[model samples]
Target: MAFASVPNGNNIRNEDKVNEFLQNKSKSMAKVYLYMGIGLLVTALVSLGVGALFAGLFSNFNRVDTAYIAENALVAYITTMVISFIVLLVDGVVIARRAYSSKRSLWVPYIIYAVTMGVFLSTFLIAGIDFYTIGEAFGISGLAFFAMALIGYKSKANLNVLGMVASGFLFCLLIGSLFWGIFYLISPTLVYIFDIVASFAIMAFIMVMVAVDTYNIKRILANGCEGNVVLYCAFIMYSDFIAVFIRILYLLSALKDK
Candidate 1:
């Protein structure tokens, strides 16, 4: 989504004036990290709950053996995707409405959605997914997140052009991955290749997004377009962070299988 314009007209008439933009940009970035933390916490709690639920459901009968466990795990994973998509749709609508009506309040739904994602991630965590793999995923993703946010906040380079290009690549990557996963069944070999490629590309994209989004936030503030720019920045940060985290998880899990 494009940054909201100020009533005065142009967003950032002077992008070179770092002093004028620093304070607000810092605040906006801070808000983003806050939301990221909250989202992570909610995800952990919810995912553990989901795991406990599944474990309980499966423990009752010898008739339901490991095959049943495997089947249930697959079903649960699919269920998570559907739920996440639906929630994301709702989040988009909420964000749009807030953008028009009450922009500052947009963070509310965002936090809720973050919690929902926590639940989604927990699914894999609970299914006997390796803790080391999860830790590695978070480690790589966290570093990536900070690096991107830092570059976006500190760098003077116009990442906007790179952002657009990276976005296109990311979209294509997703489509290609889906097709490969479904058609070729994404064998372990294929999964590894895709995971490595996706991690590198996504890391690049996330860095670009951080720069572009940070620039946009500064522009919004510079233009005097108030009302929760913090929330908007937070949203962007959370999205980048989560994507990186998930991608890292995918890469690590594929490697673990080998």
Candidate 2:
């Protein structure tokens, strides 16, 4: 008599373990994204609040007293930007160096980073980027972030090389900026061309870094890191998103000027 083949019980158990791990992984990823969203919301609120405060310094939003503020406004604006930028740098260092000690330790620096970054980013308005263009750039940034993140999540190919690529681009941008200033002294037209190329390079760098960060997030969980590490991953994602938003906003402003 011929025997009927049946599924092995051990194989069935292994499949069940795989499914359970996938479910847990999904939940963990959701939590990390939730943290990212919260950080972004904090940044948005701080940005709008600081922007209004700055406008109020000029009198009121309904009727900005251009004449009243003309003389002192530039000085105050530059001062605020300078101060916030310093705080931002300090907070970034704290997050990178100390926040990894524990879950509780991360919150203060994370929130401070969000707030300072908001204050710093709002200075763009003082430089004349309008809310409408900001909104447009934000929408585009959201789309690009989601698409790149999805690609990173689905891709089986290792993206570790992207980190090196991003670093090389960053070094080039720094060197390019130094040349930009020097070339500007010689030719204003050359500076303008540098501005365009540098913008494109920065945008490219941000996209690659975003992919690397997203892939890193997956690796973090796969390697059995604790929950705090997941939140740290969220912080990394938040930075990537904000970086892309800034570059996109700048590009939009540049295009509008053109």
Candidate 3:
């Protein structure tokens, strides 16, 4: 009597399908990183160009006059921030709906967002922050981002809970900061101290958000997402990275002043 052979064909086919899925997920993740890097580069270049142009224009002014110019620059910066915030809100809706049929449609909003961010960030230069402090802040931010991103990629534990906690904390922090700003004239010292503490807290929150966002992007790709999804993921990560960097720079500048 001949024993019946075990059927291994189905097992092999299933293994092949799993491998293919993994390969596609990896490619998608790589694309997300690429887009994020490009977005950052664009922001950096625009910021540098704008900063240099303003610096040249202000080079001939006296100290007191320069202070006046700086005050005006701060107003412009705040206005840019408000406009950028509104643009970001609209962009989020568009990305969620995948409203862009062509690549240009997607790119226009992304580029606008990056340029606005750069214009806002150029205010730091007008504020007279030295190059050394800015460089150190960038370095620290880069290391923190990479470390958190690696942990997010390697860990098996679910990060959804962490993401929720971060969101709650951020909401509270923003509300507190708003109140502090309103009462800042009443107690400048207390408000300044609170601002310092808030800066550190915000940096930590954004770093965790970077990890959470990375994990979410990986999850989305593994679930077979494609098309403009990569742009959306890149935009989220880029925003987180920039926020962390700015907070770090602010904290460093505060410490340096002391």
Candidate 4:
């Protein structure tokens, strides 16, 4: 019995087409970071605004009870951290679903970005933290982030290998920070030493990841992977920015206490 033979040419041609499309898409994906960078700027501005508002409130009140301020600070920190975490989870789910179903990512991350800034601002406002030091923190984070991103996007070197190491270090830092805090050993010098190192490492890692992901997004777009790529890209970008901000805050707070 003669079996019907299908020409493999069609399959081969289809794949070539897909590959070509992905190549073009990768270029497009790279441009998304431009928007992502803008989002970071927006977040920073909002955060600063929040800090300013809090500073003004506390400065005008002129109630300089260190104990009262510290207690309020603790509450603010706890509240913001809790709320930011919840927002992150919710945003992740929403973005993930869209990314999986469609190639186009959504802009829901912008909302998360805004809310995260708000939380941080609230922490300072409620705690009566020093805005001048907070401003220093914001500046440090922003500069480092931009520098790393520029290097990552421009450099010919591949940074994919660093992600694993960076993540491991970050995990250790988290554990150490928690344990040390429990023991009331979270001093300025210790924080400065640990945070400066950790922030540098994370900044490098995030740059590499952002570059790699940007390339991936471009490829997906070229392949006509359309639906939620925007959202996914935004989500990833915001997460990186948040990581940078947190590290900056740690370092800044440490310095201020000194």
TM-score of each: 0.70, 0.84, 0.79, 0.58
Task: Give me the displacement of residue 186 in model 2, in angstroms.
Answer: 6.8
For candidate 2, report its TM-score.
0.84
CA lDDT, every prediction?
0.70, 0.81, 0.79, 0.62
Ranking by TM-score: 2, 3, 1, 4
Question: Can you write out model 4's per-residue Cα lDDT over 119-162, one digit (the tens) per residue?
Answer: 55555544555767667766776677667656555555555556
Query: Model 3 Cα displacement at 223 (Å)?
Result: 1.9
In model 3, which runs have C-alpha deviations exceeding 4 angstroms?
1-7, 63-93, 96-105, 171-193
In model 2, the clashing pairs are none
What TM-score does candidate 1 get on C-alpha atoms? 0.70
Against the true structure, whose lDDT is highest? 2
lDDT of 2 at 110: 81
- Number of backbone collisions per candidate: 3, 0, 0, 15
Report the lDDT tens digits of candidate 1 across residue range 1-258. 899866542335555466566765556556656766776777677777877776565554456545677677667767877888799789867765675455257767876787677666766766677777788888887887777667766667776887889899999999887766554463667776776787788767766776687666655555544455556656666677777788778767766787
After superposition, candidate 2 runs with Cα above 4 Å error: 1-5, 60-80, 98-100, 181-188
- Every candidate's CA RMSD: 9.3, 3.4, 4.8, 8.9
> What TM-score should be assigned to candidate 3?
0.79
Q: Choose 1 or 2, whichever is better by lDDT.
A: 2
Select the stronger candidate by TM-score from 1 and 3. Answer: 3
lDDT value for model 4: 0.62
Which should have the higher TM-score, number 3 or number 4? 3
